[model samples]
Target chain A: MIELLLTPLHYEYMIKAIVVSGVIGGVCGLLSCFVTLKGWSLMGDALSHAIVPGVAVAYLVGLPFALGAFASGLLAAVVMGVVKSKTRIREDAVIGIVFTTFFAAGVLMISLFPSNISLKTIVLGNILGIADSDIIQMLAISAVALLVLVLKWKDLLLFAFDPNQAQSIGLNTTRLNLMLLILLAATAVAALQAVGAVLVIAMLVTPGATAYQLTDRFGRMMLLACGMGIVTSMLGAYISYFLNGSTGGCIVCLQTLVFLMAFFFAPKYGIVAARRKARRTTDALLISGDAHPVPALRGL
Target chain B: MSHGSTKLNKNDISSEIDLHVNEVTVAYNNGHVALFDTTFDLGAGTICALVGVNGSGKSTLFKTIMGFLTPTRGSVTIGGKPVQVAQKQNMVAYIPQAEDVDWAFPVSVMDVVLMGRYGYMNFLRIPRATDLEIAIESLRRVNMLDYKERQIGELSGGQKKRVFLARALAQRGRIVLLDEPFSGVDVQTEAAIIELLRELRADEHLILVSTHDLGLVPSFCDQVVIINRTVLAAGPTHDTFTQENLARAFGGTLRDLRIDHTDAPDGTSNEFRVLSDDEEPLIFGHDGRLVDHWHPGIDEEESK
Candidate 1:
């Protein structure tokens, strides 16, 4: 297996596929921490799917896909923001309505376009046969997006956790909120080219959510999420390489599998770990004839 | 952390009071008045309780003070200046209602409170040791020192309030506005928080709280401002808490809440009425009408 892995380095396309997918997955994994932490997983999904119309429009106008995706994602964010503030409806409802309508509009536009352009490839992703330019675009866009996110991490965290306190403390919460939405849009757009709309939600949510189950600390969760994304992306790619299966689907499947494992087996808060600890304590109490209660933790 | 210091020159301290609302009227987008023609002077080193019954515009008053709402008729002044000053952004610290937060956000209590120091920290800089120290000190003030690393989502209602208070404390502002800080708090936690507020007062911080707990007025407040779409009363508690004043401000609806009198330390009765029965019959004005064959004076005899 090691020899085969090393031998694949000679094939530039294979190397490109691995290196590009790893970079996208790793960065998105870090971004996922913010998404899951903010409880905006659904919003991320909405933004990711919402990129379709932009891509379609770009195709119609013969523009770069990233430009279209970014524009449409930004538009969706604006719509979501307006609906959230101006109306009494919950944010999820607004996002749902916006994404669904735009997605339908995208599908319609794609059907109306010339048949030879192959819009279905965009839905299923172009990971296996990814071209040099596609790889370059993914790397360039994802790199810039990730850099911006890291630089503004504190501001975004503040706005996400408490906008009122953020405002009162002299932070420009309005600007930060808009910046966060733009970052989300950019991340979605960058990831869109590799995993496509159907599977980007998992890439955005599962790794971060699984990391959340394992730790309560923000920094640790982000690190764990990035690690999870990298691992899942590489393994899924390798598996797809051997089996000729869908790389994006395989990646999402691996992410789902990791989430399930963390959901049940995470030592800190997982269901299985908690239950096992409870049982152990119950047995100890039965044997000792008294309960040694755990002291409550302090210092948030 | 040092914004709380006396290093601020008298002029600097005086100059920072720039939150002003002039003839501001705040109505819902639908045009229902939330605050109307409200005006008040808020200075440093005082805790003003914006007290009233539900929908008496206590929150509206706070919102107006924070510039969240534009008062329709009168304007509020901070430091004898308008609210548009550039230096005024970090001058005020506001603690909103507990329910306003989305508790499920994945962040440590420390992370939430440390955000208060964002005003002082450079925009692109990561939180420094100073920020951490300030955040921890703020948490310590609120007795949340132990939960610094705990996720905010795991906190109880009172704990959540304390966390937010810690956040405001970290802001190190001279004026702190807390909305319903004692709501859902146990007696012990409430006492702790009241002690913390008193300490803040000693630092010459101005604390404004919107609260329904009229019982706490005489003890916790240096001054009480009763608001009901407008200023009902504003003065020291003894003068402002009179039954006639309460009746006027609360619209006579809360009169049935029995007031119990207890003696003072000097053997003269303290004269302040404690809550006797939360639910009791209202004493009616003289109508000269008989009820169940008993007159107003005769009812005392008939019951015996």
Candidate 2:
């Protein structure tokens, strides 16, 4: 077991994959806290998928993939915003409509070009073969996104909790929301380097949600989530060396597993713990002669 | 139709105003006139009720005052400055509706209150020691100091209202606008909030509370501004909060009940009138003096 745990560090490709995965994971994790809190989880999914056409176009034009992906990600976000605001269609439905359309256009664009890159690789990225340039770009995007999130978290929390109050206090809620969107775009671009478009949403959603179930402080929730992301992505990447499997899938599966543990076992907010608490309350009430089999508890 | 129509010159108000909505007309992007030729001026040490029926431009007025909406024809000034400038100077505070806040968001009661000091904080919003002290004092004022570390989501509806009130208090703004503070609160909580507002009034803070609880208006508020797309009346509460003006403002929404006129043993005539807009009913004795509140569960005269 020790040898297996220590073996991945010997391989240069494995070390690089682990480091890149951990960095992107931490970035996505922190951003996911805001995404989940702002109820923008679907927006994360949308931006990730919507960048496919940009990547395809970049491949076609021989331009850098990060630039194209970032631009398309932002464009998709704007399109989603416009559609949701202009029409009576619900926001979730609008996100679905825009992202799928963009993704289909990307697939069509890719099909028109020579098959230098496999569609599978774009959709389910090969982190094992990430180029040195891609790693540098991903790390740069991660660092900048991390810095912005750290600097503006307080205002962003205010925006997420009560936008009306934020606006009332002279903070421009519209601009804050736009900043979050731009950060989300950057995160999607950074995450795409490791997890590809399809699995990026899990990386951007699960850590925050799992951390949320475990804590009641937004600051602590972000820290826990970032830590969860880094640990899980690193472990998944390392374990994938032995499993000979998809790194992104392994990372997501590990996150889902952590989420399940928190769901049932979190001290205060978990389902199992809550049920236990309820039973104890009922028992206490019954013993204390305060229980009544009438009114609210009559059916029971 | 009119009582103490205290419209003042723009220049006179610009200096002395705690809040001045001078002939403000707000139109929607589609050119629908939401608020038409509305005007009201208030100075310090006032707790005024902003009374209106739904869609009667109450929210539009609030939006304009908070600088969320631009008025087509008029301006809102606070502390001798424009709404935007006043807000930038941290002179405006708002307590939002319950629906406007995500109660389940992970934040402590103290965090919500400290948000009020954001205007004074640096760009990173690291709460200074003074900010923390003010927040603690605000929480103490609202009787929520013990719950400062508790998650805001863990609070009851009344507790939630108090937390926001504490937040407004911490803001230390001269002009405070509260949107439906009493809508979901219990009577005890309502009384407590009003008591706090009275203290704020004594401290010379100008407060505007938009509420549907008409019955409590005369009992607590010092002034009233009744509106229906325009200011129908604005002045001292007793003169402006009459049923006639409310009937016009509410437009058939108010229901009334009157006891038959009776001659007392002392030879003075006695009458009881109840006017309600389907909320807490207001009972008035002879000469429009607000009397004991009308409660469905209590037959007060018989009980007496």
Candidate 3:
């Protein structure tokens, strides 16, 4: 079993793919906690899809792909904010309109100028084709994002939980909000080389959601999310090697599987455990001669 | 109109203006004026109640004071400084309504209270021992010290309010603004919070609370500010909280509660009769005709 697992490490491209996917996964997981808590899961989906136009534009020009990705992602976020504030439209509707338009524009651009860039590679990722420069970029971006999130988790938590209270406490919530958006754009751009646009949202949201079901504390949730990200990415890379399938697809599927496991088996909050707890409590109540069950325990 | 009459005679504390809202007007993006040129001054060592009907801009006024919203016209000063300056110096703290918070957020009671100390620390600075000590002391003040390690989502409604109060207390601010602090709290917790506010007032803190409970205003609050897009009346509770001002602030919705005077059977005194919308008539003993007894039952029902 050990030799079978170690077989994929012999290939240089597989080694590079594993490293890039692991880094991207860790950063996405760290940020997912904030995104899910703030109800910005759709924002992640929107921003990821919105980056395709930027990537196409960068290919047209001589600039790097990540720059185009970041610029377009940031533009999408700013436009969403403006539309929500300036007009009476709801946020989800604005997000849908903006992301779809940008995504359609990107597809049009790709079709109009089809030379070296393939839509297949951009939609699904080209993890095996990742170069040393792409690896450096991913590592650098992930390192900066992780460091900032780790050091300033409390401020972000306060802002996400209650923005008004954060502002009242002298925290410049506008700057904090903008900072989070910028980091989100940067992380999305970094993950683009590994999972591409289509599956990046899963990486950006699943780990945090999975960890949330298992822990009641934010710190533990973050740690557990990061652990899940690395473990799942590594295991998914190995599994994909054996299955001869898409690495991003395998990784996202494994993340979904892990989330499902947490949903049904988490000790404190899982469905099965909660039902068992209810039965135990009812049994205790009956033994104590209190025939009436507690009202709070009825729903469980 | 009768301003500063309810000012307490506390000599030990400095008689500085803690909150001053001067000719402030706040308007929404849709061009609706929420608060129109309202002004008020609160001195140290006083408990002021901000009372208004629905959509009367009580929350708009509080948000402007907290620097969450900017006034279109005028300024708000705290401790003779700008609102932003005071907020940065940790001279102002706010306890928002319990429902405004995300209860399912993954935070302990201690973590929530420790957020109060963030204003004192620099960027990226962790809470130190002194901050933890202050947080624990604040939780103790609100009688939530035992639940400090529990997740906030596990708390009851009253406990949640107490936790927010403890967060406000941990700020150690000279001026505390509580928005509907009694909304979902039980009677026991309400009494405990009132007692705690009294203690804070005695310690020379300026406590400005917005509440729908007008009955508690005359007895619990030292001053009252009645607002309806503007300041209709603001002064000592006994002097400013009259029938005409309340009727004007509450509009025709308040006129449904009719109070009349009838001669007692003994023929020596007049008994006041309160006829509510759907409830039975209640009688109160009085010697003469009470011109206008404003029962807040209708207001409570309207809020619900």
Say which candidate scores most in lDDT: 2
Model 2 chain B poorest ten-residue lDDT run: B1-10
Q: Considering lDDT, where higher is better, how would the candidates rank from best to worst?
A: 2, 3, 1
Evaluated on the second chain alone, the candidates' TM-scores are 0.78, 0.85, 0.83
Candidate 2 has what TM-score? 0.90
lDDT of 1 by residue, B1-304 (tens): 3532333234345634434445556777677887777666655667788877678777776666666555666766666644433224456788878778877666789888877777767667467777788788889888899988888889887788888889877877667888888878888878887888898888777888888777786888978878787678777878887776776776645533222234335665433333321354345435844344322222221110
lDDT of 1 by residue, A1-300 (tens): 888766656667656666777788888888887787677788888888889988888878877778888888888888888888899999778989999988888888898885323566667776767656656777888888778877887777667766666665556666886777777777777777667887887888888899989887767887889888888887777667766778888888989999999988999789988899999888986676444454342221
Q: Fraction of native Cα contacts kept in each candidate?
A: 0.63, 0.75, 0.73
- For each candidate, the alpha-carbon lDDT, in order, equals 0.74, 0.86, 0.83
Q: What is the lDDT of residue B164 in candidate 3?
A: 84
Give the candidate order by descending TM-score. 3, 2, 1
Q: What is the TM-score of chain A alone in each candidate?
A: 0.89, 0.94, 0.94
Could you report the Cα RMSD, in angstroms, for every candidate shown?
Answer: 6.6, 7.2, 6.5
Q: In model 1 chain A, where is the ten-residue run with the lowest total lDDT?
A: A291-300
Residue-wise C-alpha lDDT for candidate 3, range A1-300, written one tens digit per residue: 988878899999898888778878988998999988998889989999999999899888957788888889989988888988988899899999999999999989999998466787788887878767767877888999988897888889899998987888788999989888878888888887777789989998999999999998998999999889888887777678899988889999999999999999999999999999999987887887735576666545
- The estimated TM-scores of all candidates read 0.84, 0.90, 0.91
> Which residue window of length 10 is worst by lDDT in model 2 chain A?
A290-299
lDDT of 3 at B280: 36
Task: Pick the winner on DockQ between candidates 1 and 3.
Answer: 3
- What's the lDDT for residue B176 in model 3? 85
**Tens digits of lDDT, candidate 2, A1-300:** 887679889999999999999999998999889888888888889999999889888877877788989889988988988998799999889999999999998888888885455577678888899888878888998999999999999999898888877887799988998999988888888888687789999999999999999988999999999999999999999889889999999999999999999999999999999999999978877786646646587435
Question: Every model's DockQ, to 2 decimals?
Answer: 0.44, 0.74, 0.72
